[model samples]
Target: MMRVLVTGAGGFVGKHLVSELKNRNYEVIAAASSSREDAAAGKLHGLDITDLAAVKAFIGRTRPDTIFHLAAQSNVMKAWHHPSAAVTVNTVGSLHLLQAIQEVCPGSRMINVGSGDEYGLAGKQGMPLSEETACQPQNPYAVSKFAAGQLVLQMAKKNNLQAIHVRAFNHFGPGQEEGFAVSDFSSQIASIEKGLLSPVIRVGDLSAQRDFTYISDIIAAYVALVETDVPNGVYNVCSSIPRMISTVLEHLVQMSDVDIRIETDVAKLRPSEVPIFVGASGLLEQVTGWKPKTVFLDGLERTLDWWRSRVGL
Candidate 1:
């Protein structure tokens, strides 16, 4: 069994990934940045990636066959408010891990998880983005993730390390928080179902289009990259399907039992954003034979159900 270490194991995607890895009988060592974010992480190893010395010591001790780098300051609004912190965690933290991997276990492969948001304005131009797409990185989070991916590629080439970056698109499913569109809609519907909030569902600009993959499908894509002997480069993990937020909202609203009124919440709106972001996962599929398996509607329904369960409905 290949021993794999997953950073940010407490996060939404991390939790799902960890479960799948364990189910596959991999030797998994899970670590989180702190105790507060330890729900899915198990708090087994509070490995702070920002601390260089600590990161080095932890990697040296674990010495796993592969390291899945998932740690990041993922919230966009938080990134805008604390750009330096975002850079510290997303860029510098990744550097610490790469440096540690180089020194302690040069043979260990690392999968640096990045965001599709790295494309920024460029994503707004094309129908579907590919690996060759130029990254403009609109926000602090996107900029930091883009920098981290570049740094990883550069270091991997120079040191001959087995490292690759993945530009993962928007993924949602059960147990997701209210940051993204699917979860936001689902959570509100769930809240209304549980009688926690009014029948009004407040929302932001819902005209934007995005590439959304089910969380399980996203995990499968990452696992495919791990299992297959693919080349060292950036790959997109997406469904290659453009989904409008309004359509997603309509689906969730239809799922609800109560009569709901839509209300535009100015607080929920972004300062500025790309109108659309759809990625081509052909490279990922061609290499790993991993096409998206879950239908978007099924995934959306499951997400709403998960939210309903959470609220004890």
Candidate 2:
């Protein structure tokens, strides 16, 4: 059994990835920054990537055959308020992991998870962003991810490490936090259905378009990358089709049993929004033979159902 270590194992994507790995019969270690009780309940090992010595010690002890680095400060709005913290966690933390891996497990393969936000305003030039597209990270979060991704690429080139950088776009599903748009919308609708809130759904910039992939599809891509003998490089994991936020909200509303109206919330809007963001997965498909399998509406409905069940609607 090949041993694999997953960072951020308590996160939405991390949990899903860990489950998939277990299902595939890999010897898996779930690492998280959670308390002892929470880690025990989730079957995770407490490991904080920000602490260099701790990361090195963990890597030395586990000696995983492969590692999925998914831990980071992922909230965009939160990054705006705490840019320094975001950079420290995303960039320096990633450096710690990379260094630890080089020293303790030189043969270990690594998957460095990055964000599509690295493309920034460049998406305005066309429909689907390619890996060749120049990165113009506009926000602190994006900047941090971009910097970290660059470091991964450089290390892969210089150190002979089998590391692949992946830029994931908007992905949502059950267990996602309330801050993301899809989760927020689903939660609000579920609350309204349960009579916990008004029929009005508060939203940010609904006109902004994004390529939203189901969490399962995203995880499938990750698994494919792990199983394939692909070269070291950056690949975009996303649906090529861009859908407006308004369309997604409308679909969610239609799925709900109750009548609801959309309301623009200035408070929810970003300081600067990318009007359009999407990515082409041709490279990923070519390398790993992976493509998104879920329909957009079906994924949305499933997410809504999960939220409904959570709120007892």
Candidate 3:
């Protein structure tokens, strides 16, 4: 079995990716940003990508066949609040990983997981953003991720290392925490149903449309990149179909058992948010034969169901 190392293994996407990789028969070494004690307890191996020496020593010791660098301070609002911390973890941390991989295991393939938010202002250029689009990262999170991806690609080219930077768009499903559109809507609806909160669903700019892929489909795209011989540089993982946030919340509310009222929450609104954000997956499909399988409506229903079950409805 091929040995694989996944950073940020305890996170939402990281956890799902680790499970999928293990299911596919790869020897997965789940390295979380924290949880080193878990390693002694037969759990996640702790790894702090921010520490250069630690990263180099770990890479030299394991020499994994592939490294999925998923560690990141992915929360936009949090990154906005703590810009320096975001840069430290996302950019500088990724730099540490790149240097360690280059010095210790130059042959190992690296998949640097990035965000579609990196195409910040470019979303205004056109709909269905592609890999060729110039990135204009608006927020700290986007800036950090873009810098991280750029570093991996540039270092890989110079060092002749096999590396891929994946710009994954909005994705959601069961077990997704709040602070995102779908999960927030689903959680509020569930809470309303369970009578834990009022029958009001507070929301932000629901008119803005975004590309969303189910979590399983997103995981499949990552697996495809690993299994296939994809060329270096960046690739986008997304569903080209654009769904307005209003429609998303509407569908989730429809799935709810209780009567709910939509309330515009000024606190939930983001500043200078793009009206529409979507991405094309033609390149990913053409190369790895990976395309989104779940319909948008179905994914929403599944997410609502998951929330419902969690809230005891």
Q: lDDT of each prediction vs. the true structure?
A: 0.89, 0.89, 0.88
lDDT accuracy of residue 107 in candidate 1: 94
How does residue 146 of candidate 1 score in lDDT?
98
Q: Residues 143-250, candidate 3: write the lDDT tens digits.
A: 999999998899889989898999999999987888898898898888888889999877776788889999999999999988999999899999998888898888
Root-mean-square deviation of every model: 1.9, 2.0, 2.3
Model 2 misplacement above 4 A: 35-41, 264-273
User: Once superposed on the true structure, which residue ranges of model 1 sit more than 4 Å away at CA?
Assistant: 35-43, 264-273
10 residues in a row with least lDDT, candidate 2: 34-43
TM-score of 1: 0.95
Q: Compared with the true structure, what per-residue lDDT tens digits does model 1 show for residues 1-313?
A: 8999999888898999888998899988888876554556454578989999999999899999999999899999999999999999999999999999999999999999999999889876857999998888889999999999999999999999999999999999987888888898898899888889899977778888888999999999988987999899999999899888888898889987799999889998873366778999889888889999998889999999999888853
Error of model 1, residue 104, in angstroms: 0.7
Pairs of colliding residues, candidate 2 = none
Candidate 2 lDDT for residue 60: 97
